[model samples]
Target: MADIKAVLPGDVMDTGAAARDGAVLRLGPGLVQADERTSAAAAGVLHSDGDLWWVAGNRRRYVAAEGEPVVGVVVARHGEGYRVDIGSAHDALLPLLAFEGATKRNKPSLAIGTVVYGRVVVANSFMDPEIECYNSHTGKSEGYGELAGGFMFKCTLGLARRLIGSTAPVLAALGSELPFEIAIGVNGRVWVHAEGPEKTVLAANAIRNSEYLDAKQCRQMVKELLAR
Candidate 1:
């Protein structure tokens, strides 16, 4: 793992390690290549995963990428697919045959406003994005499907990623005091549920307010929420 640091636009990233390994580097958002050099295109933290680099910041809207899991809401059914709103500029397509056990004779019937957790299968600038609720190779739902009976809300993409990542302190802090089920999508959608509606509301509010808090601060915030 490389040490990440804050970067500003036009700042060149040190890719000496990747160059030494003769690896082709993949640049993620907020970076661009010019004059045979890669430089930051936006102000944010720079991160590297071996030969890949990306920047993380507080992004509210989503730009679909292949294989990234996202939560979507069904808006319309057209032919063999459903149009879903994933907080992206274009509506994503959720195909009927893309589910784990779906068939032409038995397609998944999703009504308008139904919430779902799925993965982006195809995304392009000129075409509509496509999402699926099942793993193509394993042919299993694998936690990707319709979400029922929960409150769904949107957050910054940076916060959503943190909630889904391993070092999510806000979730851990709240989990210690209450039991809840949460589904986080990288596209900024979050669905939360608990044993009761009041607990669920509390949990959701705690998460909603934890965007800028550190681990210790998040714990204190959760404690205060519990007290209330």
Candidate 2:
């Protein structure tokens, strides 16, 4: 039986058979089939919802998935799009026309090494993933596009998720000490901007260090960092 716990690769979540209770099980990300076993493909905490099972890992790498938002860096310009490194197995495409209100004659210009936040439009194992900077339905930017000045850095996907959580205690604690703006990507990138560079660096370091900390530990960490 699969119980709530931290799991590693090759740790079996279940067998490829129906549960004894007659409930069907579904596999989510970070899980793969091996023979008749469903095992973890990454290291992290295991989570389940109803019959669904998935793993959340904290390695500094990105896994591309459709509809997921990610932070990307422009690597090169292709014919009609830009090649973006989203810390994935494959580089993603951010087309020149993928922005809000973009047109042939009104394309946005981005230099190499530009940081961007976008949603994955296409992510298939057979091809490179594609990203878009606009909401297709509303045709608005909606906070997706070339990210402005900030101290951008990378962290583990698990840490990124924790930082992005609405009630993350680390963020709350840091907010008490510094005024900052942050953007978190599920793909393991973070951008932080504060009134001063020192505060931004402090906030970033605090977040990265708080990955393994509990709520109380996180508050203590913030206090220690601010005192330095």
Q: Model 2: which residue pairs collide? A: none
Off by over 4 Å in 1: 6-28, 31-43, 49-52
**Prediction 1 global C-alpha lDDT:** 0.86
The candidate scoring highest on TM-score is 1
- Whole-model Cα lDDT per candidate? 0.86, 0.82
lDDT of 1 at 142: 90
**TM-score quality measure for candidate 2:** 0.79
Tens-digit lDDT track of model 1 for 1-228: 477899998899888878999999877566777788999877889877667687776555787777778999999999879999999999999999999999889888999999999998887668999999989979999999999997998888888867876657999998899889888888999999898888888898999999988999999999988898
- In candidate 2, what are the lDDT values of residues 75-131, reduced to their tens digit? 999789999999998899999999999999999999999999898988767889999
Q: What RMSD, rounded to one decimal, does every model reach?
A: 3.0, 4.4
